[model samples]
Target: MQKKREPVADSLAPQYPIESVDNALKLLLLLGEQPQIRLSEATRYLGVASSTAHRLLAMLAYRGFVRQDPVSKAYLPGPSLTGVAFAIFGRIDIARSAAPVMRSLSEQLRETVHVGMLDGASVRFVAAVEGPAAVRVASRLGRAMPAHCTSTGKVMLAQLPQPELRALLPREQLKRITSHSIGSRTELETELAGIRERGYATNREESEEGVASVAVPIPTRAPGLRLALNAAAPQNRLAASRYPAVAAALVAAAKEIGDQLG
Candidate 1:
């Protein structure tokens, strides 16, 4: 008779304060599930007193794990979470890993291709491939665009945890980069939601008039390294009528890059 297969067991389990950690995780999960959660709601969900929830959130905020809105008085994830994420990404050869794929995509689509990473309030292009087209979107390798405007920036923002997104962008001071730019936190949030559902993001004269772009997130094999691949062209050539094709190509490029990275 064949030997029975043994059940797989979890290794590297923690020894102490598993319950406390579990509670913290539960709180994080709860916050992540909602767009924003009030102190009372968190208290009720965690079965802790309002005072206790406040205290916990305070500690979390101090440690860079969570944040609270000043006006609405809600809680969300903090920059420290992204800090930890970047630490993981630092181990990989990000540029070397993304270059060939970007070049291939640019060649295939005949449009400028860019790879960007979220840096605080902006997305910085880390790699780019120039297309053969005579007229193309001109972008330098180190160009930074506001996260609230560009297609790559929007895609990166969409992948972030809700609280983290809120923490990065408060309700006030969402600027209008162009006439078409999103002017408020609410509108940006709605756009991000749609991007998440559609698996792509678009910028139609949002960052600059007569410039249109399409982008898709390049999921990293490691945590905290939010990256996106984008294709941009002059509005006359890459009009709204061409968005579907451009969006599909961008998504394919992102997936190809992601598979190689993974």
Candidate 2:
């Protein structure tokens, strides 16, 4: 006679997950069910020491799963998790779809590459790839910047309708980020017009003192979802003379990504 299945094995749980990982997942689930949690609460809930909970939260923070409030020291869910929901809902999956393209573009140009998403008046870097060069521009992941002063942002803004663009941007006092930043909405409109005509945009010490970038729009199947790909390097390395080649590389990568998304 064959032995009956063991009662404890009825659930078919995986056998290989580390105990700490299991606890971390449990903690993640707990965080999901609530608005926020403190470190002591995490420690108690995980039955680990304060240091262990801190380390786990640190790892999650690095991976963009959760962020801690500076004032309250409470942890909350992060933006990276939105990709999972977007994927589940059959959305464009921007970061996942653009990651390999960004990597390839960065490798080709030996410059930092970013996939930026525009929301309201801000540009958020959804994905970043670092070049092999030791002195390349730094990654801008998980940070939001004013849209009008960035190459990727211009690529996005140039596609917006005139009414929408006017509604989003202020008429004056456009926060000069640097000496190269567009000083007024009128100037920005002119700059955006050039970007639209050329099918790409360039940033020369606009967002930062020494940074320069070239960017192109990445067409997507999803409606009203504007995305851009950019290659950034130090101003001295990525000069006006190099913009065409860099823009070509970004455009090629954008086409590959758009084809995949389409």
Candidate 3:
């Protein structure tokens, strides 16, 4: 038997609250707890009339916060909601806690460092620190990029279970951001296997021209939390010969950040 899920607890009520707006916001928060919501479920959850729930959902759908599946008649997250979520998750509490460590890592490596989290098939850079070097890679905070094209994403993906990874990247033909980006899932899986064996991942002009990076997963204590630490620099500055040392440094820094988070 399945257990009934609990709704998120609310804080103190505002002095001038609107019922309609409050109901709509509750629906949005409900999405965070479940993959999809049926009209009946929303009605029951909100303890409101079916028609009222329908209207609220219709408005949310029109505004791109939710989209209803034609066949299933269930509401799922829309692009706008996803974008907003990614933006918020980029600056989540974990990112705040790891900022100083990430900054120190950038200063030590003399290269731009970033903390990225997986969001669907993309990686969202939550925090970044620019190196003091004059020609360093710039900060990528709040940017979402193709996961297969980045060391930060790849390192985290390599740690994900095969089923989850395949679900995130189901098709064989993957979208390429640059000429060097992996073009197929087969090739990406092969590289991921290597990343697993080496305990890290690397990108060499895969995400952008003349850019190179190394990343290791942050060992968070929280379950289902996937985050990585990466250091990026110019291809010449972050040469292949330096990968091992750079990767080692990133691994240590990632551990430090994780320990602090714990």
Which candidate number would show the highest lDDT if scored against the true structure?
Answer: 3
- Candidate 2 deviation (Cα RMSD): 15.0
Model 3, TM vs. native: 0.66
- Name the regions of candidate 3 deviating beyond 4 angstroms: 1-92
lDDT of 2 at 220: 58
* Model 1 per-residue lDDT tens digits across residues 27-129: 6655544445677876777677888878877878889877677766777556776576677666767678878878888888888989899898799988888
Q: Write the per-residue lDDT of candidate 3 for residues 161-191, one digit (tens) a residue.
A: 5655776798999999899999999999999
Instruction: Show model 1 residue runs off by greater than 4 Å.
Output: 1-78
Using Cα atoms with residue i matched to residue i, what is each candidate's TM-score against the true structure? Answer: 0.71, 0.65, 0.66
Report clashes for each candidate as comma-separated counts: 0, 0, 0
Score each candidate by Cα lDDT.
Answer: 0.78, 0.79, 0.85
User: Judged by TM-score relative to the true structure, which candidate is superior, 1 or 2?
Assistant: 1
